[model samples]
Target: MYAIVEIAGHQFKVEKDQKVFVNRLATEEGKKVSFDNVLLIGDGDNVTLGAPAIDGAQVSAKVLKHLKGDKVIVFKKKRRKGYRVKNGHRQALSEIVIEGITASGAKKAAPKKETKKAEPKAEAKPAAKKAAPAKKATAKADDLKKIEGIGPKIASTLVEAGIATFADLAKAKPEAISEIIAGVRGNHVTDTWPKQAKLAAEGKWDELKKWQDELDGGKA
Candidate 1:
């Protein structure tokens, strides 16, 4: 079932088990929030749409948690004016777990209860963890340095960020790279992903090398 519920002055089509992030709500975690301003509802072929909002329509959701989003640094500067302003903001967010949608447009259930059970006590046993022998460093320059824009630090950053392969970098959209770059603004590392992806996609290593050379020569 799907329902269009109004949340934070915005309407959203929500379904069961779907997760949506919206404007911050003042409710505590695990609270039930019902949206009465249901604009539309659909159950298979049957669809109910309202003029402004459907009457007797509702979408029910559980507030899984409340958290702050990533810090957004706002910087304003006027060149030669000696005017500068810098501020950091983190948007408040409410992680809503859609429980269900009702035709009446009310949050259906009060909330599900959790039953905690006691664990059985037993005598503690010491478990030894042995360090495994280090494997040969199979990682090579071809594995990383081949990328037009990525240096060792950026490569390490990518690895830590869970991007491990040329295929991964090549397949990723520029916007995805932009998001990471946004996290660490002014890090020139991600600037070359486009060139790297282009080289990797076209299998043109020589062209990539020439391009890197041009960059090094300050001719780019």
Candidate 2:
């Protein structure tokens, strides 16, 4: 029998006694961990698939060791900007051996019900009641990189200058927007930026997408 399970956001086809390396888990070495996010199981000709994940199904495994993967170099450069950055990264990983697979009847741990004594209600006076405090308005920041020709550097630059949302971008002038992103080291055009941002802020994705298709890197 073999089962497909999700461990640390990655899926794997595993069987009994199989060794697999996955994202680093918080479990200590030699400790057993059970994954309940089973997606599929197959035995001979019969197969069982989950609606996202099957309830009462689990895959048990024991952590063998932890290790780091090979270093990967990430390089970024901008033309004529004299800007270049390089970094190396190694993903932490854990090795585990599958112990067994339980086909059914695995129960999730239930939280203990707390028993609290009921308190007597206080009598309210007929005089008056205190007013509730008002909550401050919070603004949601949009992904400025979604705009055509707006890369990470330009997006961050705009954000640093308080143009963090699509609404703010929609209200900004082309010349002012250009000045805001001047330090980003790119000859970016912003004539259609406000229009695009207006469409995006209004949630007109289809219209924005069609307009972007006709645009040449945010130029008119």
Q: Mind giving the per-residue lDDT tens digits that candidate 2 earns over 1-220? A: 9999988658999999999988665456799999877877777866765545555689999999877778888899999999999876666667999999887843222121123222111111111121111111123778988999899888776765457789988988887676555445557999999999999999999999998998888986
lDDT of 2 at 2: 93
Candidate 1 minimal-lDDT segment of 10 residues = 122-131
Give every collision pair in model 1: 56-104, 57-105, 58-105, 58-106
Candidate RMSDs in order:
16.1, 19.5
| Superposed Cα deviation of residue 118, candidate 1 (Å) | 66
The list of candidate 2 runs beyond 4 A from truth reads 105-220
TM-score for each predicted model, relative to the true structure:
0.45, 0.48
lDDT against the true structure, each candidate: 0.59, 0.74
Q: Could you tell me which residue pairs clash in candidate 2? A: none
